[model samples]
Target chain A: MTNIEINTYLTFGYLLWIIAYLVAFVAFRDRARSGAIFRAALIVLLCIHTGSIVLRWVESYQMGIGHAPLSNLYESLVFFSWSVALALIVVWRRFGTDLVALLGVPIVFLILASTFLIDPNIRPLIPALQSNWLVAHVFTCFLGYAGFAVSFVAALLLLVARSSAKAAELLPGKKLLDEIVYRSILIGFPLLTLGIITGAAWAEHAWGTYWSWDPKETWSLVTWLVYAGFLHARLSRGWSGGRTALLSVVGFCAVMFTYFGVNYLPGLHSYF
Target chain B: MKKSKTMETGSSESVSILFQIKAFFTSVRTTVFLLFTIALGAILGTVVPQGEPLEHIAMSGNTFLYRLALILDINNIFRSWWFTSLLGLLTLNILGCLFQRVPSIWQDLRGRNPKTSFKLHFRSSLTIAQLKDRLVPVGQEIMRAAPVISGTRDTQHYSWVKGRIYLIGFPLIHIGIIVILLGSVIGAFWGYKGHMMIAEGDSSNKFALIPSGEARTLPFTITVDGFKLVKYPTGEPKEFRSNVRLTQDGKDMLTGSILVNHPLTYEGISLFQADYKVLGVKDVKLSFKTKEGEDLVKVADPRHDIDIPGTDVKLKTLSLDPGTIAQGPGIQVSVPGKSDKPQLVSIYQKDKRPLNIDGVEIRFLGFTPLYATGLQIGYDPGVRIVWLGCTMLVLGFILTLFTNLQKLSIELGGSSKGTDVAISGRSRKLRKEFRQKVEGAFAGITELRRET
Candidate 1:
């Protein structure tokens, strides 16, 4: 299929994902399990989403410009949702089949929403991003970001789970939500570490200087520190569950700044 | 002895009260909470403008708020003193928090084991069968030996908890915070950032000095060999690369392409491609009128004073201001010892007419471009320390996320609960997780996690 057609399909999948999740959220009040058709459709949508990413890769290759589809804001959002999908599947394995669907709507809709906000044109990377590390560096960072997005969504649910008595009553306890959140962070933090390192290493290769305190660089480190604090509080201070949710929420806010604030900041990393 | 004791006792009460107050700020929660506030403030600073002059802020639909934001330095938030102080306070709070927690975290890092049964570890009710099954997996994850007893049924569930590396996550993250703070702090005081533009053939040592504009300058010297702006077929700029020879004290430090988004650094001096501009140069022919004959001196220089030989009048090029498509570049020329009015004037371009003078006529010459370059120059002596701390910080996070202290014991012997069931025990920060894993293994098991 053509690139536009593939994107259309992906958009349709996102719509389905939203529907699945909205219904799942409503059903969560009744402690209802997902129907077979709903489960099958959600799985199909997830598969289609994954296929779209791979299709984007193929499209890039077709243009004779072989690069990862993660060089821009649009591509990153698409990849972010992909990461969330993979992570939610992992959460589903642990939490049960239905609870996983609860997170799908936000992840999918957020990705869908980003397509409208970011410029959709596929531009070639400047010589600076022509390095081999561009793909590795950005992928790891966004994957980690995507994982954090999952944790952020889970944290939001935890906030709901904390207040919505029936939701918590039927679902796994605050402890399980905490576990899922921690696991997401646990998975995401290291990837973020790798992302930052890879980005720095790429910077060293491209720009001779490893760290420039470029706004994006600074904010990424700041976000990492915030999440680092979260992991620290949860682990060392013997805090878990509720507190972990709050930390992830804060960290994701930092991630938002890292994504959007750099352009507005006066510092060096404003190049978007 | 009684008088001396009374004299000493008089100040003890005040000393104890002072110590109590001093201890409050030094408390772990207080220090951490304070650091949290600083972090929050730093986030706010990024949102708010930091270092900007009042009159300079562009009035984008609102003249009042933009003017106020400029006064607050909200645009340059990172460099502002208030923001810097917030960073400094954050650094101190993190250090204080780390100092308070490091000893215990260090002990945990040294691989201490918890010598306790799962029942005791729970601090809640636990069955003997539940304790044994948790031992094997938890032992493998933490790489610590399971605390299962070798005794038949007479074991007393002895346990001594140890998990200091688990504590290192906090200190490691604290060190990361300190590194980031150090980078920003040192960068705040020592870092110098500004931009200078160099045309196709430009070289200057004083590029370090901020040019006569409302912009900052660099410290080291930079010579631009040639600026190459590679563009796509559609004319969109693909990349702007500059081959620059960076020097400090006449010694060539480094030379490479400083492209867009790629900064070249040498001896801690970073040259970034902030932007580029074109400077247009024009040529004009000068004629000095004499009684015997005319002396025609061709000049391209825009200097205000050019010596007119054999004549008292000095031919000067006052200014070259490009007017319009029909007019092109204008050159106003005047001779010293002459009137304030231009003795000779020329609007130079092949497309436009030239200016005539008294007893001589000046012809308009062609034009050439001089490109202006902008570079952000920053030199932080503490970047290495900050970078080292950043590396360790990333490493510590990786360890914490991937590794943990886990303890599980599976007793294969006769039941300790007076039943003939195999007893299993488990312990982990992921209480629910360990419960689920253990529960899945045991038939009809209803496991629950109780945090201590």
Candidate 2:
């Protein structure tokens, strides 16, 4: 089967994992055993996802136009979902919470499922995208986006736990959720900085201008500024719980807008 | 009474106002507010097309928005006065906050006896001196630093402080941002960016500046040797390279090729391959078939007329067409006819049948496209400064996120029991892991009672 078919199957695999995690959390009552089984399944799926990405890379080489599979929208979406899954697993390992996996896997599934709507054929890179910085810039930026995605899920849980006591039982404690949000941002903020830096470096090399105030570049700056505000609000103002969680939600909205909305505007970043 | 009288004076009133100004600048709330405000302004800048002329914005059809955009300078929010003021204010606030926190941060960096977060009390059977010796190695192993040994012999204190560089994290990141802004300011004041298009075998040393159509002269002259365009088998462009020779006063300076990502720099001015354009057809190839079915092929320049090799006929190319309804990449040629009238015939590159003229069949072949490479010339004195600031920013982030200062203090004193020992420690991160390490290290001393 082709890599696109594998991606479709992996999307369903994530949906199955979500269903299995929820079922095991509710029906079995023995959370650890079921969590381990499903976690192993998730890892197996991630390995397949990784293999598919590598296979796509090799396919591009077989086409005689060798390049990383990070040159277009479909590959970005694929890498995005994979990064989100990796981020969720890392979060679960660090905090020992399966609730995040339940809450975050659906986002991964949605992002992967959305890739079916766009073209998935591997094409040659344009002259402007033929640079080593292309891989570095996209890799760092998507990982940062994944971190923000997980933080966004944690923020939603924190907001829900405030209103519903039943969710408070199923979810992790408020403090742990808040810490997760903060820690995820801490990981994302630096990676985002690196992404912007690499992007500027690439632009300087390709376009002769490090920054031209393009719409896409400006939107990335806006996202960065919003997250900077989030950090300052939490670290300096001593804000937490609902207020910080709301800030995280707003920050993720900016991230999404930076990713998708700027395509509607006229800028140089037309290739996703 | 004297202080009250002074408080009623004008100088005292001015002092209080200054104090309030300082308070506003030193507050984190102001920092957050300014960050969001600039972000909102940048969003507006993107939504509205920036760097456009005022006339274009005026013709945007909304009278009220045009007037507002004109008044607010929203057409160029990044360079507008209000946005610059916001950035300046943010820089001032960061400096103010940094100045306000430096003394405390410095004290913490140098402070010997910091307030502990976790404390453990244990009764040991060893004397105070022996306990100190035993605990020094434990502190070193746990905290990865030697103790300061800063108490009397009766109640000696062995404190280990590691990763003091973490204290500089906030300063480094904030100052790095300031330096970046400073570098940008320097670039804006001194940098020059412009574009020049040079066709193959042509060269110029002047370029038109961006946004404004003003022309600028370069120090050295650039001669275009050739322009190469490589395409994939799928007909997509793979690379564009311009071979150029830089000369000054008839002396050759540098000769190289400039690709899209591989720029050519000389004397602090760099030339980047920005774009390309097809000026006109350079040469065309044509195939002629004699009446005897013999084929003859020759390359001819489109700008000149051609004579038929075996006939008393002259052909002049009137125009070139990329393609027509029944032709692919054909050319219209004017031929001198026997009836004192010029005849027009079109020949295609991939025509199934050749055109019969004067008992000779002629067919058009493919032509070479002439391309002019667009080069962007840039000169910025502050690019190195900007790169330096970026390095500092990355280092600052690594220090802030990856390192932590952990302090372990062991206080030993004599008591009715063999000896009383109190262990206190604090870490900026991983509190549980630090506590576990301390507990594992001292498991044999006593059943350590943890106190908040």
Candidate 3:
């Protein structure tokens, strides 16, 4: 299959996610069986999404440029959305809560929609990217980003659940939500640290310097520091409730900027 | 009496001042503040173009901002005094915090219960306890259900703790950061980076350093045997490789290839394939016809003067342009006696052009191209230490985050109501989950009692 065909499948999955989200929201409001149906549909869409990614990988091989679909902007974003979906599925299975999907699905859909604006052609890898480290580095980084996305949704849920009694009844307790946010961050922080370390090793191999103060590297450091601050504040200062939730939101915004905003700036990592 | 009171007050004031300094360095607030400030500084460094010379910035019509950047050293913020000072302060703060907390963390690791005072208050269902036949069996049951670190039994008290080992991770992580800072300082003081460009079939032992713009000679020479550039069907670059041989004292030490994401290292220095370029024409073959109608052939270097066959008006080649889409190789030639100014003549690979120079017909034949490879060389002694620090940092984070430091105490004592059993615990992380586990263990004991 060609990349265009794989993109079509991804578009279908995106649409399915939107529908599942709406159904899940309605179920959350009315306390009906639609939540289960929404979950089943999400599982099915995730399968299709995985298939499309595999197909893209195969297409790259057929074209004589065999590499994983984690190279450039379009591919990374697609994989990012897939990672988010996978994290959401894991959270749902562990907690048996579909409230997270209400916020997660739309974010995934928006990311997939943004892919249409970017170039999705399967281009040949440049010499700088021809390494085994690229796959490990980008995959771990996006997974970390996915974990932060889930935490962001959990934090947003805490805020919403606190404002309305009706919403609070449908959602998990405030303390539970706070713990979820903390756990998601706990999962992400190490992964991000690993990603940065691997990126530095890769840079050393390519550029003869580990850290050049490049825009992308500096911004990733900023994101790490923000989350580091969040963890320190919560652990030592006993920050919780609204303060922790607000920090989570801010940290995710930094993640978004690290992923997207740095592309507009002039840097050595522009190829991503 | 008045003199004694004044001296006492003076000593008290000094003591309080010393205490305030210690507090400033040890507080978590200082850590938070330092992190945010460094992050902000980093963001500003990325937003502004770094490492640009002040003159360049001034020439860009931002003289005022250029002067400000010069004063603040914002042009190279990472190496600026303020940024370095911030890092130094952060390192000091981490040290102070570790000094203040390590003793307590060490005590916790030694299995000393810091919170010896216990209140007989039970509220959550998870903390509620049921009377058991003995305390040891209850502690054993809990240990069998989950991993337990330590168990203590007294006349009427028993307690079990788990995950106390993770308390050491906090101090280990701080020490790892300190190691990393030391590594960076060593690199800043002793390490050096330089760039070198060598043509095909050439050798070089010297390169220009980046910060000082001074040339440094190495102990070994690197020879570029060949350089290859592979392009895709779309004319985009796919790969670049430089086949090189390193020689020292006229003996070949190492021979290998270097490409992007791959570097060749000899001793402590490394050479990376960074860039390439085509320099100029190597040699050009020309065919000429004399005034007697006899054809003659000759070779000429683009940079040097060449005597055209059977010509007194000495001909010289000034330059050659390797062709592009807009034009072909246009050779510039000058005849000292025929004309004072040089003339341009176009040459192509497939077609031959005859030109009249000093009344002699000259035909351009063919030429060869010369290329060069750019390599970045570096020598660093602290990279290994930095890598070690990174590994410890990751390990420390995993230990501190995944392992939840928890303490559980099962105190059995008699009360006014009955033989009161109180089960209470504390956790640094996953408190709710730990509470549920405690509740599950209690439920198991309650079920056994009913069976009896």
Q: Say which candidate scores most in DockQ.
A: 2
lDDT tens digits, residue span A225-265, model 1:
68767766776577776777888888888887788767777
Docking class of 2: high
Worst 10 residues of 2 chain A by lDDT: A18-27
| Interface DockQ of each model | 0.23, 0.85, 0.69
How are the candidates ranked when ordered by lDDT, highest leading? 2, 3, 1
Measured with C-alpha atoms, the lDDT of residue B364 in candidate 1 is: 53
Residue A17 displacement (Å), model 2: 2.1
Poorest 10 consecutive residues by lDDT, candidate 2 chain B: B443-452
Q: How would the docking of model 3 be graded?
A: medium
- Candidate order by TM-score, decreasing, is 2, 3, 1
Question: Can you write out model 3's per-residue Cα lDDT over B192-285, one digit (the tens) per residue?
Answer: 9999999999999989997777999989999999888889887789989999999999999999999999999999898988899888777788
> TM-scores, in order shown?
0.67, 0.94, 0.84
* Candidate 2, B1-452: lDDT as tens digits: 99878768968789989999999999999999999999999999888777777787678787877886788888788999999999999999999999998887798788744677788887777888777767778788887766788776568877788887888888888888888788888889999899999999887999999858699899999999888899988788898999999999989999999999899999999999999898988888888888887899989898999877678787899887889656679888988766889888878888898877778888888888788989999888878887787888889899999888888888888876677788888887778788888978988555344434
- Cα displacement (angstroms), candidate 1, residue B74, comes to 6.9
Of 1 and 2, which scores higher on TM-score?
2
Residue B6, model 2, lDDT: 79
Preferred candidate (DockQ higher): 2 or 3? 2
User: For model 2, what is the error of residue B217's alpha carbon versus the real structure, in angstroms, after optimal superposition?
Assistant: 1.5
**Once model 2 is optimally superposed onto the true structure by TM-score, how far is the C-alpha of residue B413 displaced, in angstroms?**
2.5
Per-residue error at B102 for model 3, in Å?
1.6
